[model samples]
Target: MASVALAGCGKSNDAAKPVAAAGAVEKPTLKLGFIKLTDMAPLAIAKEKGFFQEEGLNVTLEPQANWKVLLDGVAGGTLDGAHMLAGQPIAAAAGIGAKAKLIAPLSLDLNGNAITVSNKVWTAIAAKLPKGPDGKVAHPISAAALKGMPLKFGMVFPFSPHNYELRYWLAAGGIQPGFYLPGDLAGTTGAQMQISVTPPPQMPSTLEAGTIDGYSVGEPWNQAAVKKKIGVPVITDAEIFPDNPEKVFGMTEDFAKKNPKTVQALLRALIKAQQWLDAEGGKNRAEAVKILAKSQYVGADPEVIAASMTGKFTFAPGDAREAPGFNIFFDKFAGYPYYSDAVWFLTQMRRWGQIPTDKTDQWYADTAKAVYKPDLYLAAAKSLVDQGVIPAAAVPETDGYKAPQGGFIDGVTYDGKQPNAYLAKFTIGLKAGQTVTPAGVK
Candidate 1:
């Protein structure tokens, strides 16, 4: 177990910390699940830093094998909640995979993923990349460099930000990333580059073995590639989709309903953990990297974990660069569970034929609302504000939808309010009324 020290506020040394409201913690002991990823820092920090204890709850943080097993643990009631892919709750609510009613009241972090290519692919494209004034390769490299090449890429899971971001980057570069059809879950119906699943920790080893030419995954794995001199990270998710929602704190609706107060207590601790992470421009991140490097957590070398966590990322040897927003926790209102974020994932699911059929804009909105519970998020935030644990300004004033924004690599605008129109704007991918079949898109 890691030791986390609590920071002091402006109050007197003798001043006692504020306690939770009467009966705010319905369940005193809880078990949470998480995969071994740097983005899982918030959960580990909350447990180690005594935030959960402050809320009158005891949390046992367990590391699961993969996303599927973690989701299963949450849905089957073995875990009170877990660090989950943003799409897990959305996919579950949409009945695309697991048949459970899961809801996300909190988003874990944003922009911790990157696309890395093996040494062979890097060698092929490095000479062709445009040089900057420094005479080095310009960043945010387009996936067009891989065009006309027979490449197999790896993603962490089917319903993951890695998959969607990889596809978006490929399509933006005029490279077909393939699609999924009914009875054909391979997601490679029409492709320029074939993509398949590779567990996060094995990405570097898999790439070295020539099983995959490249991969899109979260931190440590990407950095591990650079450390081992096996691959170079070409583009980060932040460059692909600036400030994209990455992971969420997910639990079944039944759990949330049965233990509403317990959920509130958990959220309070998580919010505090987020604040500590982004404090002082990540002054606490070094300490966080140590915690995450523990055997029970991410269990990677602290140096590799710090590659992205401490506001810097390495593309290749001697290619370190400032990436202040690489793994955001609380800043930029990252902890808020935005309905627009959920809608964006739904759009990707539809774009790739995972949805299998076209639905009305209202259906998109309804589905987003059903899975993303901003109401619960706000309730927890308000409690923390009232208790003076966090500032009121940390919460954003909104109707649960961000205004139309354009930060994509493709230069296309996305407005959550207009789902079908957004789908239509894509040059590639299924348009309105299109369904994917095993034979091909129909």
Candidate 2:
């Protein structure tokens, strides 16, 4: 096993180590894949800050060409685990990928995604936002403002949260958002929607060419719009899915079962890294940006990363606002991977015809328990907690989230235990055994 030194508050956990340390097991070296984006910060942070080493893990961090390549790496086991969309694992297990079971011991990070509109759309919408108390135009400009305007926006991929999130925000706010052509709807034919996959780096140029009016992507592309003055970032993913779990560290379920301790140790180290990020109450953000800038990872300018990661964001030309917690890495109970968060992703799967038939609340729970291993997280937490590494208060009960989840842009109250009821509440999209079958399937 690789020897990893773990500490918190800059104090060595040697005393607490023996108290909470689990049995020393063989540490397997892992090559993890990630797409170059700010939300991938947790993996970079964990690797750079020696959190992985502390948990007796030897980890290799690699940048992926795109989301498809990243998901393929983990599914094929060329890479052991990767920073993957929460939906990727769900889609994979439900036979979307290779029909393999993928597990997430840790959710990599949260809330660094946004939908940016072209210059024309921004100019069109800018006329409508309420002139705020500060003379700056109001934010979270509702999609209602885009009514009757023929808009063709871009999303990274069909099954991506970017697509679902963008669609959700538009639908909830009374916009008839256009759809992208889906490559395959589980063998269903005909055009799915208008959304076609545009890489994050190409999103701006595509919009500028009038090929698309807007795009949903993660930073620094969103920040690039502000820095380049080409377009404006209208809504952040946080606004769409408040404190939603964005990415997860995924490994084949067989690997997790065969190498259980390694997965547990990884979670322990990552949790420590996450805790350190918030130490001294989150004064380490600047340092985090530098690590993300190294050529091996995101390879974006540190300033672009810092703009969103820090407390400042540019909505339009010279329209800066204080958007603290916009790309939060570890603060605000964001690290706790709630089953409700898992269910929300599943709900979206059903919403967009990806899931086909509606499933029960228990279906959500079963899928969640299969992918999100809270028991493993608890084991890691217990080890760190008993070692006195993190304050008991810092580590929540690890049982679940608050009974009722709020902060959604929509006025929906989500309870993990009641997913079917939640599905019934939506006005748009499918619900309750509503299946979309291919034209000739019957």
The global C-alpha lDDT for each of the candidates, from Candidate 1 onward, is 0.89, 0.71
lDDT string, candidate 2, 194-214, tens digits: 456787777777877789888
Question: Which segments of candidate 1 are over 4 A away from where they belong?
Answer: 1-18, 21-24
lDDT tens string, model 1, 331-402? 888999888899999999999989989989999899999999998989998988877777777889999999
Candidate 2 backbone collisions, by pair = 4-53, 4-54, 16-387, 179-193, 179-194, 179-195, 180-193, 180-194, 180-195, 181-193
RMSD of each: 3.4, 4.8
Off by over 4 Å in 2: 1-27, 177-193, 437-442
Q: For residue 350, give model 1's deviation from the true position in Å.
A: 0.5
Candidate 2 Cα RMSD after full superposition onto the native fold (Å): 4.8
